[model samples]
Target: MALNPNVPANQEQRTDEIDLFELFSGLWAQKWLIVGCSALALLVATAYAFLATPYYEVHSILRTTQLKELDELNGTGVYKIDPEEALRRVGASLDSYETRVSFFNANRELFEPLKKGSGSLENAFAAFNEEQFTLLQPDPRKTSLVPFVGLKLEYPADVDGVAILNGMVRQAISDEKVRIAQDLEGVIKSRLNVINRQLTAARAKYEASKENKIAGLKEGDEIKRAQLQDELKALRGELRLRRQSRITQLDEAIAIARSLGIVKPTTPTSMGQDAGAAQGNIIRTEVFNQQFPLYFMGSEALEAERNGLLKRRSDDHTEPRIAKIQHELQLLENNRQIQFMQSREDEDLFLAALADLREESSRLENIKLDLSQLQLARVDRPAIEPIKPIKPIKMTIMALGVVLGGMLGVFAALLRVILRRKANALA
Candidate 1:
């Protein structure tokens, strides 16, 4: 079979190859140009290394010992003045890039005056305008104020520039911490005072209501007069005395008859059995029974009434009265009970008040304990602490010089080639 003429170009053998030796020989023809470029690059790199300014960095470490915890059940976490992954969240916000920015902005005016004094005002402002002296720090979301910050100050190193940078950071951090401490302390004291005053007032009101309920119970009722006592049955000895009163009444009646010349008392039953006599006897008996008792009772009652009554009453005796005065007494008793309940409620309220007061007292006591612990944590805050040290860096100034010098050498060689080509064409 014939080889397929339609086979892809990849199957065919390639003719071109990179001639490394020939290329090297061609470059050697311009060896002096390459050497000059290399020499220029070395000189430029050395000058740049010597001329660059050195930067000094000073840092400070800050942490919040009183960082708030979300769970109240996790008691004394803040008191421990300890850090955790949770504490790191607020720690990140405490001050990160923001603190550095504020520090530079606040001292901007101060920097200008110093620069003018050092005769570098024009140069300093020039650098500032060019965005060379920009202050930078890790974003707050990513940074923890724990161990430390790599605080930095980049200025043309000379005279007191380094000293001022160091001083500025130290003074700023110290002032910020003092202000924070005083603010936190004041907040605790203020809340404690308010709670104590409320507790005292509530306690006093509760106590007074309890005492008044006890004193009002002993005084009895005042509803009826003494005359109303007659409706009740007389006592046993009293009924016996009434029988004796009937005998005395009989004796007196006989005396009256004797004084009228009849010695014996009239017999109401002695009348004959004939209709008129029977009727008269029945009438006399009825009269005797009814009149004798009425006369006897009327005489005694009249005598007593005359002696004791200031004026005769209307004699309308029945007033719908309370038998035991039980409901009225019950009402008064209910009033007493209500007062008792009020007193009990006062006691209960005071108990509740005491519970609340105890809670507040316990809370304050815990805060006081926490404050004591925090004071120590504050002391351990590092001064001008460093998290990472900056090392001397090699600049790419030499690399740029080498590249640019080589480009110039190639351009000169290209000109020489073009001139030779033109002269050969002319010949």
Candidate 2:
């Protein structure tokens, strides 16, 4: 009846090996479960994929080029609402500032164009420069992600998902919003026209309105223009004196000093603004190619080298005057570079100012044109079409439900097995 300790130890190791084998064998032992689970997983997946609701999403992308509108964002942080502006005007002018002022005053017919209501949007909503774009929808069910959620909704298998998505898009371009936008545009055009007429009449009556004001503005502008030009000319002269024919000598010094590895530098630049409105933003980039390594040589040497190169001096290496000219030349080139940078900075400032003034001028001219057009025009709304039923997509939902059910079934089985093993251990 006495068991050897060595025999007990070997028996324990064998039991562990057998347990491993048994665990390995269970996958086959549980073959029925594997089949049942697989079938259940498949069934669940089918129900979800087929019976589930399909969802379609839609989106519109637009960029605002509202150039001067930057002032709204930066200055006041107010978003522009075209419809809102129209309504405000309509309300203000309504009933002659009194809701009960007069029947004639309350008459919206005369002011139909100015009406801020959704009705007005029909005629005058402005369309900016845009390329007409179209997109095609693909069968997402084939590789549907997040299908389970759609499946859970039990979305009608025959439910038209595309129709639903299209409806949302149509909602975005809401008829009322579009109508109101058009109306607002009309009102602006009308008001802007009135202003223009008043301005024109005033100009005609005053005869000296534009000329007088512009003359004064121009006088001030002229003084500033002259000052800039004078400074620019002076800077150019300074630059020329600094470099001129003296550059050849300095270049040799830079070549000799290049081995010292001082530095090569780059600076960022914006293109000049002469390209015009039709070009939008096309610009030519210019980069100055000047390489100055160091000022090891003097101006006197540079002058001698220049003279030698020009054949004005004999070819002699022992010329003591060369060093003196080289040093002077180096000083001159430094002065020239400084002047050149100063000129560049000045030009950039002037150019930026000119661009702003020009842009403002363009806007003013547009306003004038709009006012004139308003005086001569009327806008009409297009006919609206009624909504129709959307098409159904059943396959989308079934695929989704299947994948979700399979995952859920797997987790549930895992949990059940863990619990059963724990219970057995306790028993």
TM-score of each: 0.45, 0.24
| Over 4 Å off, model 2 | 1-7, 17-22, 46-427
> What is the lDDT of every predicted structure here?
0.46, 0.39
Candidate 1: segments with Cα more than 4 A from true spot: 1-30, 56-82, 85-98, 101-156, 159-292, 296-355, 358-404
lDDT for each residue of candidate 2 in 1-427, tens digit (9 for 90 to 100): 3455655766645543435454445444555555566567667666655555443332222122233423332222112443324333322222121221232133324323333456442231111001111222225657733111110011122333333323322232333234444654565556557656654555464435434654665565556556555655555555455453456646665455454332332122321233254266555555568743333343344445555555533322334444444444444334443344445533324232445544543453343222121111011111122243122344444455555655565555555555565565445
Residue-level lDDT tens digits of model 1 in 354-406: 77776776775565332222221221323343343232233556666777778
The superposed Cα distance between candidate 1 and the true structure at residue 251, in angstroms, equals 19
Model 2 is weakest, by summed lDDT over 10 consecutive residues, at 146-155
Error in Å for residue 244 of model 2: 94
Against the true structure, candidate 1 has what lDDT? 0.46
